[model samples]
Target: MEKQSIEQLQKICTQLRRDVLRMVHAVQSGHPGAPLGCAEFFVSLYFDILRHDPNFNMDGKDEDLFFLSNGHLSAGWYSVLARSGYFPVEELKTFRKINSRLQGHPATEEGLPGIRVASGSLGQGLSVALGAAQAKKLNGDDKLVYILLGDGELQEGQVWEAAMYAAHYGVDNLIATIDYNGQQIDGPTEKVMDLKNLKAKWEAFGWEVNEIKDGNNLEAVLEGLKKAKSLSGKGKPVMNLLYTEMGYGVDFMVGTHKWHGSPPSDEQLADALGQLEETLGDY
Candidate 1:
């Protein structure tokens, strides 16, 4: 890709991180850490990798689909979609309210653009994305399916089941990424439930796994994604264990699971915004 494209994507990622913080802090409830952590990955997919239209239709027959298995990070998804022109950015403030389309987790039944399936229960997104990939193949469409899962969420049994199914069935059109941020709600994933051999586990399941050390780095994410795309259609599903800092970009929230699901208070929000520029202006 061109330098200009990389620069643009980096800028967009920064702004998306800002939106994730601001929106979560405003509501005083939401998952900011994961969103901030996965900002670069989401930026790369929406602006560079995924072929999607801003005015997305519900059918999604022609567009590449993205499934957020760890749906608690809806703030990041909403911010990216809005910045990418999927919908009005003004609707972000209505997140988690009584009747807003932007809920804690995404639901297609709510008529939300850029989200095909409702996810929040965790560990189910890969299966959903795999099913979508199968549908794409049946229709003879070459569009790819992308799904993001949390490292802690990997402890779920269903994830491996889906992984085995995808590989055994030769679902080569899917690319699954793990936000290996090392932290989750209760504590570190290792402490909660040791994932001593994450890489080995994916490989054992027959996935072509790649690792990116710094998921917060936009350029690195783009390059890694390009590599993942190149490895697609190789008879095995592609998986990337993206190393991210949970609650990245904000010093206070970084390196801890405390801010995983809790929103920052007003003062904390002010502090966060103070640290981050209003690149696209606060909505």
Candidate 2:
């Protein structure tokens, strides 16, 4: 993939935000908060960081791979994947619709060009990523494996088990990131179940940890990703704690969990569109 400048990537982020809002609103269902918050990360990964082929294959040999553990962010991932040429951007209109490849959560049954496995059932993405990373190592494929997880999903015991396994087995080719937006479907993660001192926790689990304090900033996300990549192949898995607002970009949606799974009304959608500039044109 061709590398993009920070300015260009930022523009893509705006378009992705618009896409997420519209996709969710069109179905009047689907989670939007995490997708809105994660626009920068998704754009930076697909457009700049990932050494991937848009011509998708399940084997993923000799190419960097990404998995979304927090699958509710499907809208944003679908937009990035489409814009990056994994599938037609026009298909985005059918998101969450009946029999559409773009399901509410990413699934492989439709053979979605970009998705490798069924996801959205939280707490399982890391394990899947670890398996892929270990396979790459076994095949002598140096490309990295990346996965994104929601901070709220950390409440799941499986994440910790996977964390222990990654470090114990020295899965140095893997990089896992937590969307530390602090909000989930119910309320604040801290209120629902506090993930106190996440950096300390990951480090104690024997992994190299990095953080992006302003995850919404495109430049910051890019820098953070680069840093995480640098830490790879050092005999331990990498973890990036990315702090972002649950609902970013749109003013009304920002800073609240209410929009986590709620689609905006017609007027709200119009207002969100007004806030986001259509940089690459709507799908």
lDDT by residue for model 1 (1-283), tens: 2224776777777788788887877778888988988999998988888888778876578777888999998999999899888889999889888899998899987788888889999899999999999999999998899999999998999998999999999999999999999998999998999899889999999999989887888888989999999999999999999999998888998989999989888898888878777676777
> Model 1 lDDT vs. the true structure?
0.88
Q: Which residue runs of candidate 2 sit more than 4 Å off their true CA positions?
A: none
lDDT by residue for model 2 (144-210), tens:
9999999999999999999999999999999999999999888998899999999999999999999
Candidate 2 weakest ten by summed lDDT: 1-10
Model 1 alpha-carbon miss at residue 162, Å: 0.6
TM-score result, candidate 1: 0.96
Off by over 4 Å in 1: 1-4
Candidate 1 worst ten-residue window by lDDT: 1-10
TM-score attained by model 2? 0.99
lDDT (C-alpha) at residue 241 in model 2 = 95
| lDDT accuracy of residue 41 in candidate 2 | 92
